[model samples]
Target: MIYHGIRLKAKAGVTQEQIEETLESMRNQGRAIPAVKSFVVGRDFGGDFDCGAVFVIEDLDGYGEYLTHPAHAHTDRVGMPLVEKFDSYDITDDDDPQMGAKIADLHRRRYQSDPELAALVSKQP
Candidate 1:
């Protein structure tokens, strides 16, 4: 399995609610894409990071499809108005379970330095 993490910083003055709504819309539309196995979206309210979304896809081909898919294009169109800066990472490992745990740990460590993110980490299951 492959994981795609998209970190988004909302444009100045954009509300968290708007970001959530856009993400939800993307989730709704992303369902049609066969390559995407799972999707999760989260918003960061108190730090430099504002919002982010994660996609679990079958392979690099799926990632490519996601970039060119119509739903994705629509998502980009909608999201562009709300995003200031966006970055993405492609993650993979031989073991899916281990990879997931590692990803969580990575996020935990990345966020641990920031008090706001540390609080967010404490809230995760």
Candidate 2:
């Protein structure tokens, strides 16, 4: 499995509700794609200066499917116009063991510590 972490920041002056709605719609659209296993969208809760979303995709191939999907193209047409960036990482025991462990620990300390995210992570297969 591969985890594609995407971060998207809406244009200035855009409301959080609008961003959330657009992302929800995008996730729905993503579900129709063949390769996508699951989609999770959430707002950045770290601080006030940041207005962005995080998505955890199950597979890199699915993530590619999403990029080329018509619905995603339509997303570029509608919504607050996001500035998107992504980091792709393969889930492997041998690659950067130390760094991967640190990142996993951080994720646990941050999102997993929260009841909602903890539940979400726990539910993942």
Candidate 3:
């Protein structure tokens, strides 16, 4: 299984509610897509981006199908207006489901000493 994470910040003046609504819509629409094994979306309280979404797909082909899904296209077209900029990450280790978390924790610990990161987290709303 492959895990994909999308980090995004909402456009100026966009509310958290709208961001969550858009995420909920994606989750609802994913019900029909066979490649989506799991989906999660939310704000990252102490992270770099304002909000993010995660999707668990079986493989590259599955991820490709997800990206091309009509529902996904529609959501990107419509919802992107509310997004400022987004970054993506994909992690896979064949069968280890815990790889994503381990990798994230490794990065977190590595960067924990950066004063700028502390400032960024402290400045969050």
Candidate 4:
């Protein structure tokens, strides 16, 4: 499985309620996307970010589906503006040496296809 994760730090003055809403939105994205095998949305304890989420997908195809899902876009639209810092990474148990490059390519194509997502990410600190 591929575990795609994101870490987020809320902007200054962002209310607790808004943070909760964002967290719930992350959970909603996982729930709405069929390609997601499982997911986690929770606070970060000892890191630069305040919160984080991880979505487990079966393979690259499922990862692509998760990346482009409407619910994922909706979550980004609602959550990104409140994020002060953002970091994303992927961990996979696949043995292929090229797996990392392949995963990066998936994200590159996603950004090329969705300019709005690229723009949203560019705004992060």
Q: How many residue pairs clash in each candidate?
A: 0, 0, 0, 0
lDDT of 1 by residue, 54-117 (tens): 7888765566666557776566666766767767676885566566565555445544644653
Each candidate structure's TM-score, on Cα atoms with residue i matched to residue i, is 0.64, 0.49, 0.66, 0.95
Comparing 1 with 2 on TM-score, the higher-scoring candidate is 1
Candidates ranked by TM-score: 4, 3, 1, 2
Q: lDDT-based ranking, best first? A: 4, 3, 1, 2
Q: 1-125, model 2: which lDDT tens digit per residue?
A: 44444455555577767776777766766566666565565665554323333334444345555555676555444542443332223353335547466545545454444565445334432
Off by over 4 Å in 2: 47-61, 79-125
lDDT (tens digit, per residue) of candidate 4 on 1-125: 99999999999999999999999989998899999999999998788889999999999999999989989888899899999889999999999999999999988998899998899888787
Instruction: Pick the winner on lDDT between candidates 2 and 4.
Output: 4
Relative to the unseen true structure, what is the Cα RMSD of model 2?
A: 13.2
TM-score, prediction 2: 0.49
Better candidate number, 3 or 4, judged by TM-score: 4
Residue 71 error, candidate 1, Å: 0.9
lDDT of every predicted structure (CA atoms): 0.67, 0.50, 0.68, 0.92
Better of 3 and 4 by lDDT: 4
Worst 10 residues of 4 by lDDT: 116-125
Preferred candidate (lDDT higher): 2 or 3: 3
* Off by more than 4 A, model 3: 95-125
